[model samples]
Target: VFFHNALPFVGFGFLDNAIMIAAGTQIELSIGVVLGISTMAAAALGNLVSDLAGLGLAGYVEALASRLGLSIPDLTPKQADMWQTRLSAHLGKAIGVTIGCILGMFPLLFFGDEEEKLEEKN
Candidate 1:
């Protein structure tokens, strides 16, 4: 059950971070320069885009998670409401999202801080 609860959140965190990073980097490089916005502002806009994408893609993420062969345990309503069960689910989601966010940072390696380069050139 813990694994079950965690699985979808992993996908959510991964996509959220990955999209935010990639989109933010691009926006910072392109639109930010043209509009003279700060990097943080670009990042905020990128987060907005990522959040919108998350809303649209949530169902797909859930479907992918379901395909991973992890299923929720068959529990009675009372069993499902137990404190231990709820705790496990929460802990699972926390750990899973942490792991997935770390994994999603791979895009940073490729992005390589274009801002640093611009600063150095100036």
Candidate 2:
């Protein structure tokens, strides 16, 4: 059960591995599965990871753009969601998954509970 919680970390590592695995292979496998999805319809079978990533990136981009006085067309929630899909779809699997995977792992570094460290002290 303890190791199960660590799955998130392992999952994110695989996510970013697309960059190392060669761009050509990204099409061959679904985004989440490590063995690589063998089926021809891998993209459709993949999770909504691009949308999640798009939302994360969009928030950061919007914030920076605001500071720079650059305008974002759809600040509204509904429109912003549509924008996220379009952006992620345009980004494609190779680039989108790589960036998203790295970002996904970033929060774990600062926010996750240091349970292992506590165990070591006992």
Candidate 3:
């Protein structure tokens, strides 16, 4: 149950991982720390940041697209690198945490108990 509660945090980090992977970060799940409590923490943090930043990122990109009359998905190599660096620099931990949470969540969901526990009623 203790570990079971931690799944969402792990799931929260997927966006961060995607951004980092685009930015060329090396992910080593084979390492010890990658799956430790740190990973869980990272995932929660990522979720936190993504929840907040995702909104802004979406709006910001939309605004940029409107202002520049450019396609958001068509970022140049330098633009991609710059954005990746910026996002990573500010949101690295959160991103890593998000990634960890996403990957971490699967096991919990698949293996978690389907039965519900009822509390005592007076």
Backbone atom clashes (below 3 Å) for every candidate: 0, 0, 12
The per-residue C-alpha lDDT of model 2 at residue 103 equals 56
Q: Give the per-residue Cα lDDT of candidate 3 at 93.
A: 45
For residue 22, model 1's alpha carbon misses the true position, in angstroms, by: 0.4
Candidate maximizing TM-score: 1
Q: What is the TM-score of each candidate against the true structure?
A: 0.94, 0.27, 0.27
Q: Give the alpha carbon lDDT tens digit for every residue of 31-95 in model 1.
A: 98889989899999999999999999889988998888877799999999999999999999999
Model 2 spans > 4 angstroms off: 1-40, 45-47, 71-122
Candidate 1 weakest lDDT stretch, 10 residues: 113-122
Candidate 2 residue lDDT tens string, 1-110: 11222233334444433332332234433242455455334433333444454445555643543565544344466754686655644454445445546654443443
What lDDT score belongs to each candidate, Candidate 1 first?
0.89, 0.41, 0.41
Better of 1 and 3 by lDDT: 1
Error of 1 at 106 (Å): 0.6
Q: Give the TM-score of candidate 3.
A: 0.27
Off by over 4 Å in 1: none
